[model samples]
Target chain A: MTGWVAVAGLGPGDAALITPEVTAALADATDVVGYIPYVARVAPRPGLRLHASDNRVEIDRARHALALAAAGGRVVVVSSGDPGVFAMASALFEALEGVPAPHDLDIRILPGITAMLAAAARAGAPLGHDFCAINLSDNLKPWVLIETRLRAAVRADFAMAFYNPRSASRPEGFARVLDLLRADCGPDRLITFARAVTTPEERIITLPLSEARPDMADMRTVVLVGNSATRRVGRWVYTPRSA
Target chain B: MTGWVAVAGLGPGDAALITPEVTAALADATDVVGYIPYVARVAPRPGLRLHASDNRVEIDRARHALALAAAGGRVVVVSSGDPGVFAMASALFEALEGVPAPHDLDIRILPGITAMLAAAARAGAPLGHDFCAINLSDNLKPWVLIETRLRAAVRADFAMAFYNPRSASRPEGFARVLDLLRADCGPDRLITFARAVTTPEERIITLPLSEARPDMADMRTVVLVGNSATRRVGRWVYTPRSA
Candidate 1:
């Protein structure tokens, strides 16, 4: 069999949001690899082998997928939301950099509905205007860089979407982010916290920056801070196209 | 029939990239309205009426969709990518702001795989780091704001995806943008021009900022400028997870 590896995004949480392209990739795969939760989203079959690992082992998972594919197995590496956005696609490429032998393997990155866009759609179009997406976790980068990007985004008057805002290991980062936003964006700037978006436990809260607390977000949540012009239109919150 | 309006994204010219949620919405739609090219993507059924209009009439299209839905016709406003991202969702809300009667109408924005992400996936993960999306068309906003955002994005070391980079009416804007990028990002920074992405006519070209020309991008293209750390791995271009 001609082997290949497809880094597929499953979208946010809803199965309906999964694209037919990703679905086809899964169907054609003989082995699937990803974080435990994401791998569980795939169905079990007679010939397919599922290799699920814990979080923070992304590089190892990518290496494993490459090995399987190099051995002539069709491998699908799954990620929640778009694989290109803070997900598995980059990690897979990073793995490729560490080893030269697998450079010739067939690899494809399939895009999906990322968390920010899904949250933006659910809450109306707060990101309708120009926007910036920042990952708040300081695990890969320093806190100073995050602050700089946040400040620069505010200066540009671009709406902001924050990923990996809060986690049990790093609870203080999101609070500092909130503090910075309240100080820079002032009290009335709109902020949205969408938890487990598109899932059964989905909860969306939109309030002013002054009213936002760090506890409003968790690892499963994606936060959105609007530009200076974003506001509520009746029950919906949107940034004007002109702004 | 219970009428509603669903602003749907058709997912960058590929039928398989469209989500089941949008497909279900279109199947239930009695009338579909959008720009001529986007509306033409939807198949016509006996009961379904397709309303294709020329471009630059987003507000009028929004108003028409609202009128249809308010008159108890299920309507879907189609956009090429996610409706909330420089597309029809915000325009729909802007139309809602003009008239109060349609405030009670049922409306939903269905997310799709946007062109940038599709292009990024096709060229590997050049948007893996913190990124900003800007619409280079100065139709709604002034040219000064675009320049400000571009400078700020570069200062913050964020990769950028530019939409509507160049059009027939405004051919000189992209040349200016290329000049600005080369000045700020230096000659060695990588830039990718992906035109008609995910389509049969798709073409992707990657070069240094010094080598990018104004003619490389058109209205059908989405341009990606890498962060300082973005580079080529084998034949693929990707931004590393850690900058």
Candidate 2:
């Protein structure tokens, strides 16, 4: 058995977005591991073993995947969005530091369409120019750092796209970020709120930042705050390069 | 017959990446219009009228597409990557302003993969945090505004991706922008030069801002400059949010 490990991005929710290369990698794997929801998106094939768990077990799941590959099993670890973007790719590497004796295990990462890209696509070209993506969740980091980054992005006049903006436990974090942004970027900035993009429940609304209320967003929504260059022409929203 | 238009994004290059919904829309269209290269990418179908032109005639082509749709025909205007990002969607709307029509024309934009996302995926996730995209092309816009935006992005410590960095006529512009970035971002910043991402002749290299030579990139290359938080770990590059 070949000791090999591959990290695959499942793209947004739609299975059609899965590339042929990703499909081939999964088909050749003897073991598959990921968050429970992501693993269900792939088609089940013969001679495949799956290990699913809740979201908090990232390190544990990575260790299990590494051990399986070290034991001479072909394994593939899955991440919902692009693996390298705040996803399983880093966790897998961090976990590898603790393991010893396996110097020849082949490891590779395959990319996929991230939620930001999918959301940007659905809401016109708010990302056409310079932009930023921030995660409002302060579970691992302090609120101070998040606030600093938000201020910097706003000062730079970058169209901003946010990920993990709000969660059930800390819903007020997004509101605070908005208040700070409103102060720096002003009220007329173009804003786009997208939820469950590329899925059946996909919802997208384009409005001005002044008109955006805190209740308009949730954990699943990705909020895009346009720079001063962004403008609305009829039903569409875009940020054109200044002449 | 009802007049309608669909603006479709033809993902990076491979036909497989085209969403099923986009394919259905294209199949049902009576006329297709785009720049010559983009129109050639789609497979040939019977009874479909093709309207192709060079890059300089975008306004004329857009006006022609609108006229076709207004004559009670289903029209699809194609663009490489996402239609709304520096493509035909906005131009189409700009051309529609003066047309006198009795019926409401339905215009829909279907999103596809953007070049920055493809480049970010090819390189590691240098875009994991706050970032910006700046166009180095001065053909349509003044260079003064571009410089202003670049300086702001650098001072803000936002990772930046530059589009149309060089051309045959203006090979020195990219180097000039790099010099300005060096002043604000410092010489130690990490930069990635991605050429033809997700294509057959793809090339990706990571280097430091001080050592970045203009000869290393061309018009086809998309330059990604990492913020202060970005780091290089062996073959991978990443930006970690402050904890």
Give the number of the best model, judged by TM-score.
1
Q: What's model 1's lDDT at B65?
A: 94
TM-scores, in order shown? Answer: 0.99, 0.88
In model 1 chain A, which range of ten residues has the least summed lDDT? A96-105
Model 1 lDDT per residue over B1-243, tens place? 678999999999889999999999999899999999999999989999999999999999999999898889999999998999999999999999887765677999999989999999999999999999999999999999999999999999999999999999999999999999998989999999999998899999889988888999999999999999999987789998888
CAPRI verdict on model 2? acceptable
* Model 1 Cα interface RMS deviation (Å): 1.1
Q: Across residues A1-243, which tens digit of lDDT does each residue of candidate 1 receive?
A: 789999999999999999999999999999999999999999999999999999999999999999899889999999999999999999999999977765678999989999999999999999999999999989999999999999999999999999999999999999999998888889999999999999999999999988899999999999999999998887789998888
**lDDT at B202, model 2:** 86
Q: What is the C-alpha RMSD of each candidate to the true structure, in Å?
A: 0.9, 3.1
